[model samples]
Target chain A: MESRPTRRRFMEWFLGLGTGLLAVFYGGASALALWPPAPTSAKLQDMGPVSAFPTGKPTFAVYTAGGAQDGVFVVSQTSGPPTVFDFHCTHLQCAIQWSSGASEFFCPCHGSTFNIDGAVTGGPAPRPLHRHFAEVRNGHVWVGGLSS
Target chain B: MSRQQGPDESRRPSHLSWPEWWAERLGLGASWREALYHPVPRRSSVFDLLGFMTALAFLNQVVTGIILMTFYSPSVAGAYQSILAIDAVPAEHFVRDLHYWGANAMVVLVGLHLLRVFYVGAYKRPREFQWVSGALLLAVTIGFAFTGYLLPWDQQAYWATTVGTAMASYFPGIGSFLQGLARGGDTVSGATLGRFFTVHVLVLPLLLLALLGLHLLLVFVHGQSKVEEALPEGYRAKHRTGDHSDFPAGDFQPFWPNTVATMLGSALVLVAVLVALAATHPAPLLQQADPLNRANYQPTPAWYFLWIYQLLKLFPGRLDILGIVGLPLLSGFFLIALPFIDRNPSTQRRKRPFALAAGAAAMVFVLGFSYVGSSSAVGPTAAATTASSQAIAHPSFAHNVEPLLTASCQQCHSASSHSGGLVVVSYADLMKGGGLGPVIRAGDPADSLIIQALNGTSQQVTQMPLGGQQLPQSDIQLLSNWIAEGAPDN
Candidate 1:
């Protein structure tokens, strides 16, 4: 073992080290990519309180998450936390307009309408107005991501 | 230098080899190795490699599919769970992805193989069965995709199967029968899953293997037709009279070492690519199917079938008769009848202008249609900006005004026993008003006749819930509020 190394032996050792390093590098890279990657957290943005909204009328606010902006509806009836909704109509995605006297959200594109509680009330909407995440936390209603 | 040379002809290993000794002891000849792995004369070309690639793709699919099957459950209840479990296993997604990507590759490779055959005029007079069998194999490959799609039992799979089977019902006479056979009923049910699983696992594989065997046998027998040989006799006489030194036989390599080595290398490369893809983009699995919620999911067929889906959209209403049945039938007939119809057998691309143009045009048209189909507008008008991006979640319909109407009013104003011309069956009927007049003005339900009638404030109309106890004031207020809330059809 203590004998002087020949050129061939030194070359063999060098190539072996390189091959082992290559194998480990590839294995690690593949594992990082394929081995059930760490569960992803949702991209969320904070929108402030329910009390900021007036009772019996929807407060239209622009929710900007992931650099995309869209109108969101915040309705506070007997508020702890207001019911937050995607401000677009369920049927045709036109920005919904809440008529105070009529007490409903109407889509100008189509006649689709939704109740104050986000239920589709009329026209051709097959579902209710989509809701966003809103929860009462530390005296303030915080709205966040729609999905993970 | 010749591959056929032995170490020494006088002292051959064949006389004393273990294989020969075993063969003699077993009362069998020592020809098995030669029969199976004999030299292919090293004349392998891109066409041979393409054919080999297709077979490799098939082999990959079978290996991955079988491994997947060991974990796969065919029943409706178990399909999704099994998939989830398989996904949980380390590297299982890689195997499944390989199978998924391998399926697409198989279809593409088979297509390239066919195209290669067509260009070389290998589908000519003596080799007609090869073309026909290959066509049938293509059908079987697509059939495999169709059947395998339903195995996942997800919403996308379920609805795609529904639409696919429904389309089968449009063929003139045997359409219904075909639909029934595919579906195992009038609709997609547990039976459909059973049938699809059976076909996916047993039937298609059997058919494919048989056809592949026949296809390979014919190919070996014909020994891969040359471009010059594919030419018409007169054309061959005029342009290329002598064999080009460029021909394969001049260098003549053997298949055992050279071609097989390259084939193995390409196969390994293909598998590596599949692994990379699987690692990067695992095949997605949607939520398990909810049959009752069919309308909630958008159904799109696999990419290969997208052109037909796009065509269907182009042909609406009465034109559907032509789109669903006639168009596909015509194309299929054209494809199968190609060899016979285009008898001008000049394999040279320059010599056949019209045929090449027609083929090229068809390819462009199909590709164009597929591109449009996968990304085409689903409705005449777009609904939501996010609709195109992701699966559209169903909005909550639980709190819709319908429930209140159904509970409070339907008893008296039900369709069977309407007070006037009005029935409380649906939002439409309720909005249409009674025999008196329109009851609910969508946004202005407070002034609507139903509210007026319920409040007993209408002079002409009698109090609603006439025979029953008067509704709670809160319920009446709720009703009026809902009416004023635009009466959405949630």
Candidate 2:
């Protein structure tokens, strides 16, 4: 027997469809809004002149722009372009120290050690220290975002 | 029609009876009356009041949380200042303190409620779903704790959150995704604060309310459980299909007068405890977060999580997964599956001796671990001891302080660079000061601009070594002690 759809059943089906659509729309919207947005392209921050950094010595080069301060270690090699290391240690993101005596970078927080090339030498550091996108252009060091 | 013919209504014009009119349209009053008038076991003791007390504690949290939202600014730049502003006013500070204490109270009350339920074997057979819902409530309560912790925007809040999110990133496959989702970026910043505030205020509250509604509905449907020994012999088989009305009608009394009085008393006691704690010991707000000074601050989890914090220490490096992921999952599973796992229908404590013993041992372990975690030194305490002990009795301006400055500060503040119009290259140049003022005073380290900059305490001046890591405590102490000894060329 063919059954004719009543007004009550049709209304119930319509309401269910409306609710299903609303759930999908709200859930999708929330997920889209909450997911971390892609990082924007970073502006290059100037870290003083090439002459400020001495060869084989890692010096703190701080950049202050629009009142926000950020820093990096500019290690000027004897012959090659200077390499800039991120200020924070890879182990747990504490500031790393440069020891003139040992010529190694040490994380004061957890005792992780990194050599001049930013390679992890000892302690609980998971990997090598991260380097920033750096260049010595026009005799001044400019650092961009950290290398991927 | 004079249909409403009660003796109470006889004194008034029955046509304009507002209460009766509203109750007719709203239509929930009858059900509410019925629920309130339901019967409960006559000997319902103080332990039966745990669930009610927990709900009251949650209500207090909600009220205080709403009050806090009025003053709290979600942005990173304004958050710390807003907190300081709140703390400055005595009344506001008391409110904040109450909210702080209320959160801790909620956690404690919920845990106690769970324990009381577990001990009585109330989470068996018919009440299995209730136990599952209660377990989820526990998780939500903890979620509230974690999300609220970051709102203060202090050093303690920032670094603790940093370590916490980092731990979350250790989960097997979607670790990085979870970390990014929680942080709203690669790091804990303003975005993270915004996310936490939204969750703490909006999302979690809604979820908790829905769960609470379901939980309370189940409780009202089933009524309070009888004491383990009070159950009849064929209790399980007899009550398998809702045949028994709530519990055996031996000496059962109306839930209104019987349980309501006890709950109201407990609620009053909870309020007194919160007030006393808030008045005597106000909440702490540490210095504004300095990401660079992660070396200085020690980040510890809240007291409820102290056991897990200790567990992380026990299992280090690769095995950190065990403490962070494995244990929480294991405990959660055990809680949810408890009713099924212990299938013995007998609810008496003596009959389930092994289960009871195991639970007791777990309690001891948690308590012991929490004690150890509270005392454990996780940060660079070794550095602090050395720095304090070696606080140069007579620090030389020439030998001790000058060398330290030349290494760390002179790069930007030298004669040629002079980024801050301050020069630290020579002793004479340092006295002249910079763009701010005289960098040093003869015998006042506390008032000296140099000390203020180095310690990052001056609101007017930027932290010295600008974007770089803060000078080590020993180095800062050397300079301060030198200035105190009266700036002399030794």
Candidate 3:
């Protein structure tokens, strides 16, 4: 009688353990499948020639980087490489406009303002305007992924 | 499964009717009659019919949704087109409208039912799991709405889903994983459509049916709550033994003719309202999704989610988790733990003042916020650009249009990589037409395919530049001007 009860107890424990392990395995596998893999970096795109932009002016340019449309303001300096700024405001990602007279980039959505150098000058912008990886290659302006 | 025969079973006829034959074979005849003719509280009124109305709304949705599935395509490329085709047929479009309006009615009915149950303290004692199951059913109903909203693949569907999934991705550790699971990838592509379709059509419905069965079964087992007085001592022991003779002699009524009639009558009224609303306002389908138009178009969540949308606006960056994940979890925990927290056995509304006050306040807050959220206007709030300092008589192809094409268009529409059989490498190549037809017609920007594609006003193709971003409005206007200048080869 003692042996029979002990064997039943053992069987119950074994079944419970087996069920628990199965549940854990399934849950973990499902989570792993849902989790995203490491993101791949964006490639560079040719964004027309450097000479096309007027010197000492914030000219607007649009290009596709990493399968996304990115509007940027390229302020062509009198000398050295130009400063390229992402068009969105740092506060909420609204499109930023260039005002040559005020010499500042204005985000009309919330009145956030950034200077021509991409520094946050006024309003709710938490940081400076975002920049793109830019380089002059064979007279053409190549823009890569976003650089914070 | 053998059992002692009850008095009703002993009087069965020698020859069974068709339904009785199948029911007897299935061993369900007596049980079915018992369940259908079970006693309910005599005080049950029209308000108690909320659950039945909700179930009826769900049934309508299932019928219409199955019919729609016969024609619906669960693919990004085909979803919008299929909806358009459905709209062309009057009967199908009306059916679609019924499904759309039925979803809203079901949500409201569920809310009303939950409110009734809470007010009457029906979640006490043995009915705790019943409330829990009802809560899960509420969640599944919402899941159905969220997944179904993405099936149309129009601009409203795409952008609203984008914002929704992005909000879900703000949870601390598992945020990104939630987004990936919901969207099936980094972006809302074809994979997202397929995933949402499967969840909306299959998974959620099955889960709902199971939970609903459990919830209804528990209701019958426990019997409806007696709101007139508190339970006497030793009630729990008697309840456990299935002795529900606590109610007064004449205060009980059978569920079949009395309650079922009222429930079905109210459901008929709900059906009439849905039909009238659907006939008056068929579901609106906006333009095909344009990823590039994000800056110009405002994405608003569905009406029921407006309160949460408005709440997010209260918290700034990083702290958005408070509005997104924190509040929802807190409220959900509170809802599930209500029975434990308020241990009072009294079913009287006056006895539960604190609970009633808290519930009332929450309802008011949601309604107020939803009002504020809905009143806010949507679409293209982007400020107009400052005029250019210098205005040229005409845009030059070499200096202006060609470079713009090279920067934005040439990636997909160049000589070596002509995506749609149209090349933008040269003015001549551009004028030569794609597989469809000439993309540009001289001096007519309105008719030009390229201009329409750029501005996302084309009915023939999806928005240009495939990615969910648009060319700056200024660049698009410039292109329109260039084409209007006769698309010169210069």
lDDT values for all models: 0.68, 0.77, 0.75
lDDT of 2 by residue, B121-189 (tens): 899878888988998999999999999999999987887787778777778998878887998876678
Supply the global lDDT for candidate 2: 0.77
Going through the candidates in order, what is chain B's TM-score? 0.69, 0.73, 0.72
DockQ of each: 0.01, 0.27, 0.12
lDDT by residue (A31-136, candidate 3, tens digit) is 7776554432366777788988777667777756444455777877777667788776665455666543244576543356788788887655657998877777
Runs of candidate 2 with Cα error greater than 4 angstroms are A1-21, A39-43, A55-58, A61-71, A88-117, A120-123, B1-34, B38-45, B227-253, B378-406, B409-469, B473-490
Fnat, 2 decimals, each candidate:
0.00, 0.17, 0.09
Query: For candidate 3, lDDT tens digit of each residue in B1-490?
Result: 9898888775656687665766777877455555555556677668778888899999999999999999999986799999999999999999999999999998999989999889888888878998989888888999999999999998778767876776677778987788877877655667789889999999999999999999889876666666223235555345444455563347656666887887778878998999999999999898887554454544557889888867766766556678878998888888877788888887778898988898899999999999886665233542122111111237778877786677677778887888989898988888898987999899998899987887778998879877745655555656667778888877
Model 2 residue B437 CA deviation in Å: 24
How many Å off is the CA of B322 in candidate 2?
Answer: 3.5
Native contact fraction (fnat) of model 3? 0.09
Clashing pairs in 3: B291-B468, B291-B469, B292-B468, B292-B469, B292-B470
Model 2 chain B lowest lDDT segment of ten: B382-391
Per-residue accuracy of model 1 over B244-361 as CA lDDT, tens digit each: 2232443344445766788888888777877777788788788797553212333456889888876765654445658778998888888787778888867677888888788889
**TM-score of candidate 3 versus the correct structure, residues matched by position:** 0.70
